[model samples]
Target chain A: MKVNEVPQDGNNFKGSDKVKKLVYAVDKDGKYTGVNTKGWEAESFATQQAWAAVEEDLKETEQQVKEGVLSPIAYFMQKCLMDLPLLAKHVGKWQWQVKRHMKPLVFNGLPAKTLQKYADAFEVSVEELKSFGK
Target chain B: MNSTNYQHCQHAHCESGVTSNLLKYAGMDISEPLAFGIGAGIFFGHLPFVKVSGTPGTTFRTWPGTIFKQVTKTLGVKVHTQSFKSVDKAMQALDDVLATGKPVGMLSSVYYLPYLPDAFRFHFNSHNLIAYGKQNGEYLISDPVMEEVSTIKPEDLIKARFAKGFPEPKGFMYYVNEVPPTVDFEYAIKKGIKKTCFMILSPPIPWFGNNAIFLLAKKVKDYPKKLTPRKAALYLGNIIRMQEEIGTGGAGFRFLYAAFLQEAADILQKQELREFAEELTQIGDNWRNFAYSAARLMKDRKSDLVSFDELSDMLYNIGTEEKQFFERLKQVKW
Candidate 1:
């Protein structure tokens, strides 16, 4: 999702159900509380909008990063994590999550620990990963 | 036109109907030399004929006569020129004439430094705008160096140029049957063509974007007969060499230099001269980097497809903006 459109608070899910999928958290009102795209479908209204917004942001961010507005590592971090609010819960666990989850997505045919190691780069915890589904 | 004679003579503005906006903001180091060359090129290349009429001290009508002469010769059209004894008279005279749909062209010596009133320097630049024809009774002129083709009241044109410095016009103009083509420079650069020749040759001379286009169009006169990488490399190399002789700088120089090297590198890359291409690539990258930085400062990056809002922000953060245009397109890491 676009950085501006993203919810600043941890919970405020006023967006549609499609948006709800992109958000792992929600208030009692069914608004998009936060970004946590654990199961974002391309076809859903919220997911489509979120994807569109994210794509646009990514394009801009990529240009900014390419021009050195952000460092390479920071760009990669924001690219992989910022849109997924679920990743924010793991804050300190970022390295751990990168070791466990992102490595597999980034590299092909890697060993099991590679994912864990990538997660370890961000220090993400297994509990945070489990919470992503909730 | 001897370089030294024309160089010292303040006739740089006199020679070319078009002035290099690039000259006014040139920096200390290389920009000065480049500006001189560009000025030389603009003046000598554009203005070829000068006529000091009305018996020198009596009612001298010193204007860019050949520009009109050539137009009239080619198209058989007449242009208007008026000389006023005073700034007010000049302004009134131009206003009355343009009120009938004729805009006046001015020479820097007569209208600006010698005659124009102190309160009217701004209007001097407006008078420099080459008069095209009238649209809806408003005098139309092609102001390629600043604003594109626009129609302004004769009074406003006189007022702006006069405010800028010159109050009276040095040249006379009338409606020519043929309107000059708005030449495209970017397309020529993209297609790997030498542009300086076209700038020197084209009538009323192409300025900036339009000048750039005509040069390219002339280069590729035969459609579907594309400039091959090898040929383009040679052509570009020649351009850089000419630019060196002309003392051109800024985006114009850097772009030519970068394009030359890039074309050479592409040729080598195609020919499996990887190491050579890599070296050329380094040279090209440096030139491109510097050109882009200079262009950003000049607010001349419209060719990069960047939006105005982006340009404003980019101008604020120039260093950061440089890479945004040149960043290697990364493979979409899905």
Candidate 2:
């Protein structure tokens, strides 16, 4: 793409006013030049769609949490964009142990230290995590 | 050891920019595109079995750290590299290096970096940046995708470096120790181009290289038949995001590579490579056209399997033409 033609239809770069990504385009002289673009239409759509999918999952997880079918750990895990394997690894527990913690009954009987581990992994407070879907 | 001499150039890709910036600081003049090309960073992979964010994995470049390793090795630059199992030790090591006034490049996760806008943050674990020094407890950052130097708090930096996932950073860090004053660009460029050609054309499986493009095309062709419309659109949108949104410098590094060929042509004075550069630019445009068409289909979501047929056809042509492009590049006389 030419420099002038480089699409600047900008997405506000995910709502940040400050950062602009660099794009390599040709100038009028047909020489390659580095130009900063706020964003482009195609990119913005893709990002939105991905985030939308995540949001949808979040909603479903929220519904499950409300029904007590899953524990708050599941909600926070999805909120953090982490899968069970990742959250388990981060918390230094086996996947099955982490999966067990996602059960509301199992999560409720967990000790404070256990809750703290999951909260720390998600970068949230224990209280905030426990308060999910309330 | 002081980083006062360091010049930060925001680049299309993080590792390539970090590679270029580090080389420039070492007193060698290397642009981002040149570093990317010399590092053989451009690539194509669409793995059906591997899932990223619930969509099939699609990568437009070589694995992370390959560019830095290959480019430095090829140029005989000495580097200090290490990975840490202990987070405290890692942060301490970073501080110790910064204390000596040397800048260090390291892997990070975009999700933990708050300096970036919310729109761009994700759980991507292989983002790269440079830590020049510590100031009032915040680490100075020279992220390649950002326009200028920024700072990150120690806690956030720690989280970024330690983000748990595939390709985990594990607090991996490196810095250039020495760079030769005089180097051979002609040889490096030729090697870079050759490596790229081999990477694209020599992979034996359909999950990688040019063959992967056709593999994904086949998948796209079946998306409407096999998956929900939303799912199909998500799969295609993920492709665009990987190709255009995630900073391949446009057209999944096609434009960046073209820029490198143009620069290489100037250095080697190869009129033939210049012609190849122009041709690749057109090819890059075709890739953009593919993205535009795909995005339109994704937006409408009303089109039938026939539209899917056309989209897959466009991608099939891209794969075929790209295969031919590399083959011809492999035959370049110099």
- Leading candidate by TM-score: 2
CA lDDT scores, all candidates in order:
0.30, 0.89
Candidate 1 wrongly placed segments (more than 4 Å): A1-134, B1-83, B88-127, B130-142, B145-156, B163-250, B253-290, B293-334
**What tens digits encode model 2's per-residue C-alpha lDDT throughout B1-334?**
2377678788999999999988888788999989999999989999988988788999989999999998998888999999999999999999888878778999999999999888778889999999987878788899999998999999999999988899899999999999987899889899999999999999999998999999988999999899998999899889998998887889988899999999999999998887888888888888888888888888899955338889899889989888988999999887
Candidate 1 structure quality by residue, lDDT tens digits, A2-113: 2232232222222322111221122343221223221211112222233334456667766654554432323344444332232323233454444443332333344446
Docking class of 1: incorrect
TM-score of each candidate? 0.23, 0.97
Can you tell me the DockQ of model 1? 0.01
Name the runs in model 2 displaced over 4 angstroms. B304-306
lDDT of 1 by residue, B192-256 (tens): 22222233333354323223323332342321245443333233222222222111221223222
- TM-score on 0 to 1 scale for chain A of candidate 1: 0.32
Which stretch of 10 consecutive residues in model 2 chain B shows the poorest summed lDDT?
B1-10
Question: Residue pairs in steric clash, candidate 2?
Answer: A14-B119
